[model samples]
Target: MKKKVVPYLLVSPYIIHFLIFIAFPVIFSIVLTFHKWNIISPMEYTGFANYIRLFQDTLFLKSIINTLIFLVIHIPLQIIVALFLAEVLNQKIFLRGFFRAAFFLPVVVSGVVVTILWQQLYGFDTGLLNKILVTLGFGKVGWLIDPKIAMPSIAIMATWKNVGLYIVLFLVGLQTVPKHYYEAADLEGATHWQKFFKITLPMINPTIFLVVILSTVGGFSLFIEPYILTGGGPLNSTLSAVLYIYKQAFFYYHMGYSATLGLFFALIILSVVIIQKKFIEREV
Candidate 1:
């Protein structure tokens, strides 16, 4: 009896913490999704109204589309760039450790600071990039101000910010390939491209899948970059799903509606991940 009681006592702290914090908040949010609350008033039960309204919310739909667009550009770009960098780093190179650290430095830096830095870089009139363009006989491009270009610009910035972590992941994947596979390919007179396609890619398929899923999740969570850089403008082009949900929750104080949006968005992520898992698993 003492042994049994001691075990429960030992684990009680973490169990209590999980229930009070994570479990309670999650259950509360789910319940809140079925009601209307503005933080000041009592919760007013609305059943499925919040869910129904979410589907018809054109702006929220647009934000989801905006996030998908970001993923379309970001995922491929990230995979290609990170894989190329990983391959290069895997080769014997000068100052390899320094290069690795430099690439990853932006990832560890604060997101707000990175956004602010990119904001300056994207400035139309006086940005360093624009200054360079002016010197090279080109007109200044609005990196964030233009509606059509803003989301793409944000995607590019996001790729730059997160590519280093992917680089390291790819590096680990690249290293795990058997050295003798490359040796056999060499003996068979296989070209670099042939070896890469046949051996390297297949070997790294799992890594590719992981990167895709992670990139998708990160792309969907895009908020700080656009929030700071464009404020979800110049005409709502950069409004991400997360940002729209954030605005609904805080700016508009639609507490219940925000909870509904959160739940809906979670379902979207789960669906996307499941589809990816099925497709990639088939390929594997």
Candidate 2:
């Protein structure tokens, strides 16, 4: 009895911490969303008014569209590029550790810092990206300034920052695949393409699924990059759901409304992830 009690005691701190810090805040925030309060005075019950207002807010709707577009652009591209890099690095190569570390280094850095750096890189004049484009005989293009390209530019920056982590994920998955499968494919005169599709891809489907879910979540929640880089500007092309929520709660002091947005955002993420999980499970 003492031994079992000691183990529970050891974990009690973590359990208590999560309940106090994470769970309580989430529950309290949900409750706060349905009532109008200014952190002072008396709170009035508003029922579903906050949620109803969210549906009528055009900027909020635009934010939803932008976030979905960002996800469509970023997630698949990140996975494909990461898979390719992982495949390249999986082969017998010198400096494997160095390359892997180099790729993953950006993921560990702060998102704010990465966004600031990309801002410079995406500058219209004298930017490193434009400079390279000009030197390569391609005309200089406005990466962030042009409304049409602003979201894509942000998406590209996000991909650069995140691809390294996914590369490591895919590499770990790639290593777990049995060499005997490849050997068997070779014995059957399977070409490189055949071996990759028939053996490598199916075996690594789980990793692809993981990358999709993670990247999808990250893309939908994007804020800092657009906030610092474009301010969701260039015709609101880079606006995101989280940024919209931030503007509503902090900038406009509509805490209750913002809470509704948060709840709605959470529901979208949960629903999409569940659907994706079911699809992947069926395929498996």
Candidate 3:
């Protein structure tokens, strides 16, 4: 038997790259999760103590709850607004590309830059929102400063920053739906509500699913926006899982605990995805 030289040569680079970059790091991180390291001292194995400690860590628990709150706010808001915008734009409107590019512009900007920009917008004393609220006879509110509202404020910023990309995604999905489906429904004497429920809604399930998964992942990994804007809070209200992990790994120099958090967070993400898949399948 003769192996093909060209195929093997072509794949050899990829194999080497994966082993060096992906495989090795993944394996090393897993090993690192069980060992204590402060970079200067020798690494000492501590079994599952770091993971066990998570249950008793208030900051870690707060981070989890804060993340869930962000997701609860951001995901539904992103989906609804994106879908609504997509539907409006799909109606054979003028300047279609212009609108799409406008919507998707924020996604192209650096996340750090977006956070900075939104921080200014969400400023407690002189923010655009506060000015507008005051102009409209509403009380001047501390959007990013109040502990009760800090996470919600960050959620709003995050949603505004990323909703444009999801709009484009939903728009592309909407375009795939044949026009004749609408025509058939029209001939069948269907109302707008009926057509949307029976035709448009089901047709865009996959897009909705994709947005949900991405929004969920982004929600769980939130750090920069809260960190840059609130430094995880006027209290600890906006502290997130990744910010906590960063503090453990870098700020506090607890590499093993950080790795344990990473592993646990990964499991949480996996669980959410599995649940989403199951729910979607059952509905379908």
Q: List, in order, the clash count of every candidate structure.
A: 0, 0, 0
Extract clashing residue pairs from model 2. none
Between candidates 2 and 3, the lDDT winner: 2
Native-to-model Cα distance after best TM-score fit, residue 38 in candidate 2, in Å:
3.1
Across residues 8-72, which tens digit of lDDT does each residue of candidate 1 receive? 99999999999999999999999999999999999899999998999899999999999999999
Worst 10 residues of 1 by lDDT: 217-226
Give the clashing pairs for model 1.
none
How accurate locally, in lDDT, is each candidate?
0.92, 0.89, 0.88
How accurate locally is residue 270 in candidate 2, as Cα lDDT from 0 to 100? 93
Question: Candidate 2's residue-wise lDDT over 1-284, tens digit each?
Answer: 89879999999999999999999989988997898866566877999888788889898889998998888889888988999999999999999999999999999999999998988998788799999999999998889988888888888899999999999999999999999999988899999888888889999999999899888877877999999998889899888999988988788777778888998889988999899989988987
For model 2, the superposed segments whose C-alpha errors exceed 4 Å read: 1-11
Q: For this target, which candidate reaches the highest lDDT against the unseen true structure? A: 1
What ranges in model 3 sit over 4 Å off? 1-3, 188-190
TM-scores for the candidates: 0.95, 0.91, 0.93
Question: In model 1, which regions exceed 4 Å deviation?
Answer: none
